[model samples]
Target: MHEIISGLLEMTGFSIVGWETILMWMIAFILLYLGTFKEYEPLLLVPIGFGVLLANLPGAGLGIVANELVMNPDGTYMTLIDIANNYGILNFLYYALIKTGFLPPIIFMGVGALTDFGPMLRNLRLAFFGGAAQIGIFSVLLGAVLVGFTLPEAASLGIIGGADGPTAIYTTIKLAPHLLGPIAIAAYSYMALVPVIIPFVAKLLVTKDEFKIHMRKMDREYPPKHEIKHMRVVKIAFPIVLGLVVAVLVPSSAPLLGMLLFGNLIKEIGPNTARLADAASGPIMNTATIFLGLTVGATMTGEVFLNLQTIGIIVGGFLAFCLSVAGGILGVKLFNKFTKKKINPLVGATGLSAVPMASRVANELALKYDKSNHILQYCMSSNVSGVIGSAVAAGVLISFLG
Candidate 1:
């Protein structure tokens, strides 16, 4: 009877549960609370939180992926059928979709369909700040290497600065798949906290007078001598021209930029192609996001996520985010010194790729200082360009490290 009892206890999963598992459970609960109650990135956080919960459950094999099934007997890639048989559903999802580097570019296509490039085309000068914003990516790359990370790991961590979740995910999967859980969580969490972070940093770096620079007023005083003739034609041709230019310089970026530009092209074609754009940005994007979130969260097993490395990712990711914002602000400050038409520093603050949220936050900051200072349109110029800039930066890292 004593031997029987010992065997039963030893065989039970509950008996094997350790402090690491408990900690992971707590982390899952916290993420759930943030997603449910706080409403921070509910779409992403909710799925990811649930995935984390499912992965940490005692005795459950839902999160287990058979890593050995990567290749077959002849050294060929396993079919999805084989993967499903050897690996579980979550594992299948990770290997088939996320691991193959499939979904991020698909998500980028949706982002492209939803994006409006008109603002960026007109305010060409403002686009440089977007390029400047990428300074955070390279900055953290060196920072991570100094702190003892491999180049690939550092490259993956650095992309958190881009503030574009899909870009960060794609980069990590290519360069440091092991760090995906931490990197993805960090990237999306920081993106969600854009409103709070932007204001906090603006308070420290931007002066009251600097916030009051009226972008619209400056535009009126220094209007271009001529309006862009055949605006529709220009809009139609922009994607094609830019895609070719990007392809020549950074061919690796094609997987991301190619899809993005194609999505935009469909959107620009107007009513005749509205159906394609709608499907790309709506149902297709939504489905991809749900699967992406759940699978990414499942990757955060207890042993993987509960470590000093995750702590480093959390801190380093935040620094990358802040430095990107600071870089954009300082870039504009430097530009202001050289040019006669002064720019509002808040315009630079919108250079992160958090989309309309970043632009909206900057616009609100401007309004707080002066009621008439609406900078949303100007903000979008850099905001959109930041999307392009971050992808290019990711390609650069991959080319160098991968």
Candidate 2:
């Protein structure tokens, strides 16, 4: 009777549920609560939170398991069958999808298909703030190295400042694959918190008068003496020219930036290529996001996440995010000091690559100070440029580090 009961208890996984497992469960619950009740990045956090739970459950063996000896004899990766046997299904999926560095660029294609560059083309000068926002990435790179991280590890950590989850993930995969879980979690979580982070930083740095600065009024007061001719042609040609330039200058980034420009190219080409655009933006992107969230969360086993390096990532990533936001705000302020035509600091605040969300947050903040100040278009100018800037920054890092 004793032997039978012992065997049953051991098989059930009850005997193995320790404080560490419970702690991971609590962390998973927190992610779920934030995604569910707070409605913050539900698409990402919900799947990730559930994956964390599934991975931590004792005896499930669903999480990504490490095996240094699983490579093929020829130095290629193992086959899916071999991976599934040695690790779990999650590990196999991760190796097949993520380790290959395939999904992030595919997601970038969807992002490009969905993006409209009209706002940016109309207001080219605001793009400077987007470039200015990249200061956070490099600054954090140096700071991280000074604080004891290796050069590549610091580069991966620093890319979080760009506020582009795909860029961060891609950069980490190349430069610091070991830190992917913490880096992805930090990047997306901060991106989701755009509504809060933008406002928080704006409050600290921007004055009430700066927030009240209406961009349209300034444009009306100092109207452009010249307008871009054949705007449609420019839009169509810009992505192609830019892609070629990036290919020459930063070939490493061609994978991501190339796909993005390709998606944009198809979209700009109109109905002739509409199907490709739709497929990239809809079903393909959705599938990639699901796999990304789940696999990334699976990498968050207690042994991986519950470490001092994770603590550094959590803290360093926040600083990088804050610095990026502050850098944008300060860029506008500095530019305003010299220019008669003032730009709203809020426009700069939207320079994060979080896209429409960051732009929306900045637009809302602008409206809070002046009810009629609609800066969404102006914000998009910086927002979209930030996406390009971040991807380029990732490319630069990969070129130098990887």
Candidate topping TM-score: 2
Q: Pick the candidate with the highest lDDT.
A: 1
Give a tens-digit lDDT track for model 2, residues 1-402. Answer: 999999999989899898888998998999899999998788888888888888898998887765455576787777888898877898888888888899999999999999999899999999988988888898999999998999999999989999999899999989988788889889888988888889999999999999999989999999977698887788899999999998898899899999999999889988999999999999999999999889888878888888888888888898888899889889999999999999999888888679999999999899999999999999999999998888889999999889
**TM-scores of all predicted structures:** 0.95, 0.96
Local distance difference test, each candidate: 0.90, 0.89
Q: What would the per-residue lDDT of candidate 1 be over residues 250-285, giving only the tens digit for each residue?
A: 988989999999999999989999999999999999
lDDT of candidate 2 at residue 196, scale 0 to 100: 88
TM-score of decoy 1: 0.95
